[model samples]
Target: MRSTFSSRLRRHALLGFLAIDMLGLVALVVDQVFSTDPVYPWIIAMGLVIAALPLLAQAVDYVLSTPADAAIVPDTGEKIP
Candidate 1:
């Protein structure tokens, strides 16, 4: 696949995951406000997964897409031999 295509797909996937995380956050808040002791742990667990999915996706995408020998972010200030 072309780099542009892959990058755009990654961007959209991350955005989708982020939306899920945000919704999970809302769920957590709503649950907290309404109920007392039953759903909090479950909501928190789901929230953690939702929050981590995007970051995990990003790391996987970067590792799979990038060359193993290449630096993740190049040093822009100066280069020394």
Candidate 2:
């Protein structure tokens, strides 16, 4: 993959995880404040699944990506080779 594309994917993945985390935190607050509501726990559980998608995608990308594709470090935007 191109360095710019790889970096974009990483950034989007991080954003996706951040969104799920924020939602989970909000759900936790709701669950605590409204103990009678049973939906919050389910929402929190769903958030867990949503959060795992990026990890799963990364795992697949790692397994299938070429060495050249991995040469570019997204964090530093540097090509190792």
Candidate 3:
């Protein structure tokens, strides 16, 4: 159950980032071609930053939630029987 939720969060966060990046790109082009205002780019940047916040928080939580020792890969350098 826990893993499912964790995976879901990661999936959603990545999707959100992808969406924000694509939208920002589109907005930049639109602003350059159709709009004269420069604020649109700033607005897109702010949206990206805001969208990143939850992803950052969730990433930190995901890292911290795991056991410290688990982060280290075991040495497969020498196999001891």
Candidate 4:
């Protein structure tokens, strides 16, 4: 199946968040090892918040796409007995 632009955007956003989180972690480690006054802990926290944006976007998308009265069905083809 071909992916839509929104899906691509979401994926890219998630990847960007991951990159930022990784950079923040590396900076935190470097700061702790070298500096007496640390500042990158806030960067880590900001990274966490940034990571959550993709999740929040996903949740909003799910809520918006699903119909209010939609039936719940398992992906497995097995019928309920």
Candidate 5:
């Protein structure tokens, strides 16, 4: 059970990393193509930051919601028998 949880966590982390990297690449391309003025770099930076916000929120929620032990907890606010 622990191994399965760890494997799932690793997969989630990898997916998050890929998502951030892809967002950065897309922002870079957009800045290079659309913005003609000197503000392009700042635009790219802002875009990346905005894209990362949701991932950051999810990570925080995961940390907060996970218990010290390995028991699965449902988010429905009801105790399971």
Candidate 6:
């Protein structure tokens, strides 16, 4: 059971990474195509933020689901809310 849960978490993490990377790529393309000025920094920052959403979400989930006694553990063992 724990193995299955871990597997699911791994899969979700991979998907999240891909989703973030895609969003970053899209943002880069959009900025390059539409902006008149060199907006690479802004685009990169936006991309970073977009990419970070899933990670942030996961972190929040972990935090919320974690029991007080296991707060120090990297991953939450409880069911997500």
TM-scores of all predicted structures:
0.43, 0.45, 0.44, 0.42, 0.45, 0.44
Off by over 4 Å in 6: 36-81
In terms of lDDT, model 1 sits at 0.67
lDDT (tens digit, per residue) of candidate 2 on 1-81: 698798778767766665666567766776787775678665765777576667756765675455775535454765556
After aligning candidate 1 to the native by TM-score, how far in Å is the CA of 34 from where it should be? 1.9
Q: Once model 2 is optimally superposed onto the true structure by TM-score, how far is the C-alpha of residue 79 displaced, in angstroms?
A: 20
Model 2 regions lying over 4 Å from their true place: 40-81
- Model 4's TM-score against the true structure: 0.42
**Clash count list over all predictions:** 0, 0, 0, 0, 0, 0
Off by over 4 Å in 3: 36-81
Alpha-carbon local distance difference test for all models: 0.67, 0.67, 0.68, 0.63, 0.68, 0.66
Residues 1-81 of candidate 5: C-alpha lDDT, one tens digit per residue: 998898678766765665666667766777677766656755676677677767765764576455866566655777888
Clashing pairs in 4: none
TM-score of 2: 0.45
Candidate 6: tens digits of C-alpha lDDT, residues 1-81:
998798679767865666666666766677767774656646665767676777766764675453777655555566654
Candidate 1 vs. true structure, TM-score: 0.43
Candidate scoring better on lDDT of 1 and 3: 3
